[model samples]
Target: MQNLQEGERALTAAVAAAGRTRLWSHPELGLHAFVDAAGSVRLGTSDRNWAALVPLVEATATGHGRLWSGERFVETAIGDRLAYRGHETVEDGGRERTTIRLADSVTGLAADVVLETCRGAGFLRARVRLVNEGGTPLRLESVTTLTLGGIAGADDGLGGLTLHWADNDWLAECRWRRTAFRDQVVPLSRSVHGHEGRGCFERCSQGSWSTGRHLPMGALTDRDGRAWLWQIESSAGWRFETGEREGAAYVALFGPDDAHHQWHQTLAPGEEFHTVPAALVRTEAGGLDAAFGELTDYRRDIRREHPDHRTLPVIYNDYMNTLMGDPTTRKLLPLIEAAGAAGAEVFVIDAGWYDDDAQGWWDAVGAWEPARGRFPGGIQEVLDAIRGHGMTPGLWLEPEVVGVRSPLARTLPPEAFFRRGGIRVTEHGRHHLDLRHPAARAHLDSVVDRLAGEWGVGYLKLDYNINIGPGTENGPESPGSGLLGHHRAHLDWMASVLDRHPGLVLENCGSGGLRMDYAQLTVAQLQSTSDQQDLLRYPPIAAAAATAVTPEQAAVWAYPQPGHTLDEIAFTLAGALLGRVHLSGFLDRMNDDQFALVRSALRLYKDIRPEIAGARPFWPLGLPGWDDAWIAQGLRGRHSTFVTVWRRGPADGTSCELTLPHLRGARLQPSVLHPTASDSTAEWDATEAKLTVFLPRPDTAVLLRLR
Candidate 1:
């Protein structure tokens, strides 16, 4: 390894001799990278403070080098021996992409590290492309999409850093945990040991549910309020780790690997593979909220353009706490009428619309046709009724699985389904489809075309319920690599569907938020946040959903029952006002007053949705806790700021104050924007930049506008 002075002199000489250097900096993106003559790269926010840095490409392959290799995914001999080839940049619109190329002389392995950023943005998107140039096959164990180091301050090394990550599961999703960096990665006294630590704090996904265990997002914040927020965009397997390195802190994000997801790849000569994308945002002072806000902007830019994001039509699905998959014509017509009357723009007949057997639809699902026994007059009758009420008709379909007993399971070729050791894979009575196969892709394409094109359905709710363990085995490919291939093929199929029917809307749901990741969100128009039935338990998920998804795409259910009090109805409705409204429950049985309350909330949401499309999210009271008594979330727009505060349990205090540093010392008038007839009151204190909201009763929430 070259010393700092020697590396600088080499860079200067290279630049002066051939107009090339080992240092590359992008002023517009605030990105600084150092690639030594040996092809070793180090990335950070600044250039002057680079020291004892980790390599940009941390990879391990079969018959490769591992210096003190143990559990950590770093310090590989191949990453250190690669020689720098060249780099090029391309500018398109306001975004610029730079590709740094490198290759290993010993193994004939090559890599292209692609980095992209928008002009005037504080974030960077990175991915790697690998090719095998040697005659022999190379089996790769693990590869990093992005690695960033030099995270500590000049005075405080790792003492002032705090680690933040979110825990996700069925119903209980987006529960964040924050701890001191030292707690997870304790001091090892490397000065005396004469070596770096072998362990680090790591989080990874399991099975098919990308977010079943933990969200693919995490952060590190300093005492000075600076933060680095990052997310790995993969619908397959993903892992991220942060630990103390050379007295500082470093984070490495990856997509599937042998140790984590049973994923590996054997590349033949001239074959190439591209890893999933990952992003990182650096905020100098505003902490997590500011970093998330920047990430939100980046998400909006990466998504496929669709009108559904801007319109944000209120969708009423008869599934959660309502029809519960038994959607008959007798049960759906009334609800469709009530939903349309309550201001729903789209009505979805969820789940059991296809069951004809008395046994159940769970294990007999593949055929998406309407059931004659349930619909009697045919499912078209219910869809017609929805359209008559001026709403877009939709149907729920899980296209990735076929019930083990379904006729298609036997008819389709065995290769169309996921298989290992010449046996088909089954999970929860359903067989997973391998979309990479032509027959599987053809079957789904036919189903979607029949519903969205022939039937004139304007929306389709795509749900994935089962976790099919690791993945299918395709010859020499590992299960993890097969899973990655299937996921990418699924994404391509969805994009093709949209290309055929440009006006249609697709809702991404994985037994409600389990498959929540940007790789799916970028293609789908909406994401179901959760399937929690209790209204009190949903505020935390709703408040913190924007950390993983954009505001317009995060769909929250608002199911107000006929038996609830007026306040209870308001509570549920207000939670969905900031996000895409997923209305359910027995609206047909609600009294005139209850129906009017639902209508009024939807009307208010419609009026404010335009601002929401462009607003940046903020946590006035910080990110919400699972059991917090008082939860607050705000969206800062160009013209005004909107805040939603929820108070739960037996409140000891009737009011709580939310600090808004941006509005401090500015003249403002704040007012409650929802439940015009409620006891909720809000007062703005311009002097302190705080909004004190009073909801006299428990389990109540209010949305306030400060301008």
Candidate 2:
């Protein structure tokens, strides 16, 4: 083994800056972080080291960032005010780890900054742990997981840096945009005072929908072409911001704060609380793509080892198209038989099975037991039918909420549900469960165990549709704090369940991508990207999903219905080609021609699905627009590259050209992988490094595999 020099790599720390600070080096990516004697953190890339000391700390307050802190400020980890306590370095499985402890000089509060760098992953994982060192309890507002100071440096200013973030909505997720700091320029003259950031760039996700409004992730590219990508891997409420302080640039991220979700906690003496982990990747020569690609690798590394990561099975759910929540034993038998014949490995029976009331099933949920009135013979018959077709049986469950009119809603104690001002919080005909309460966890665990243990259930589509705004102010310091506790409890419960039932598959669906965060992605088998019935609007969402999620775990709906031409059917199926193939619609009603096209797409998906696990995403037309006439997305694997193009609306001609940057000079054979209702053509322009596709009309798509 070779002994590397101090402060060269592997998160080695050493004295620097005339003994004023300690420098920690990230070897694989060549990024350096400095902790001053005052415990202020700073960052510098290999391309450019800093000349002025930058303060690496951010908190929810009125003085920093653009967002308001809800008129409450608990100043703890906010600037150079914290004192450097001590640190420890350890090694595990050839990976180096460092945990640096910092404390508030005025108060009996302290925090630990955890840093981990692997051998060759070219990324670092950072998280913070808050501790109360006082004899009395201490109140806490919010703290950042990781803060990078000197993003652009004091002398140079933020003019050289570009800020990048993604806007994620329900149906249209992972829409990324880049902006230069100079564009939103807020000039601060050094002649008057020191550098102070103005007009800070800020973003946040409210409520339980972690990705509802915007992704808790962003990136900064410096003038020297070096880029840094940072993501807060939390499923609950989170926020991140970029701002200029003096001539330097700073970035701060936190899980939850009082301003957004009314969250604050009083830490008891000797108690500790840890925030969610954040990932940062620095690229030496490449820009955003290079940094983002490294982030993709980091995302894969954080995911738990599971069978879904390997098998990449095709799933069939009878919710969007076929059943539409009117499930019966009679109706499910044929769909089950047909889906199995179509080669779907998992068969999920969607909602409407738990209803016995004549009104509807929406308000009669929470009692997960199947309604004998609807099934006539027993729900077991349908389960057996699914198994008889050689497919795994799955069920849809909304375990976190109790319908307003449900019997359990009236029976369970009010403490089990989220409450504000001594009353239970209700939204959209439902009451949100506070998983921190023992009763709530017990009820949910009972429901899950009954379904999985007794009924032979293998897969679960966990769906959350409602959001209790702000948070639950049951008995915590604030509503946001209570919600954060519930969120942590929920994750712990999920980990326990998965540990107990390793083979069980959990599908995450929060009104489709609304609650799609890394915390859920680590536990859930797959995520349903959207429930957009409009196939036309789904292409952009499906195409851009790879920016925030792995294509392998992303499930896009492909519902081929009757009265559809072969081209139209292929278009719908192609929407799900690059991601998970969630086959839908009334397959029992399709003719031989229509059914053949459906099966063909599934077959093609199975062939390319394995590559998706190891593939890297590239968009030729740039991050897709909501109403673009043409869109192209590509996935480049080790051996072959798969590209899908959509000619959605009116176009000038029968052909359009797309550039594949990864295969610019390589000789490749291009083939139209899917035979649609109409004839298609693909021509490779070697000199231009573009592929020209010939299509007959609008509302059509095709998959081209370049080998």
> Highest lDDT among the candidates is held by which one?
1
lDDT on C-alpha atoms for all candidate structures: 0.89, 0.77
Error of 2 at 24 (Å): 1.2
lDDT of 1 at 162: 91
Clashes of each: 0, 7
lDDT of 2 by residue, 470-549 (tens): 77877644777777778888888887778878888888998888887888887787887887888889888889887778
Give the poorly placed runs of model 2, Cα more than 4 Å off: 1-18, 37-39, 46-54, 59-78, 153-160, 188-190, 193-198, 222-225, 676-678
Query: Cα deviation in Å at residue 97, candidate 1?
Result: 0.5
Per-residue lDDT of 597 in model 1: 92
Candidates' RMSD to native: 3.5, 3.6
TM-score of each: 0.97, 0.92
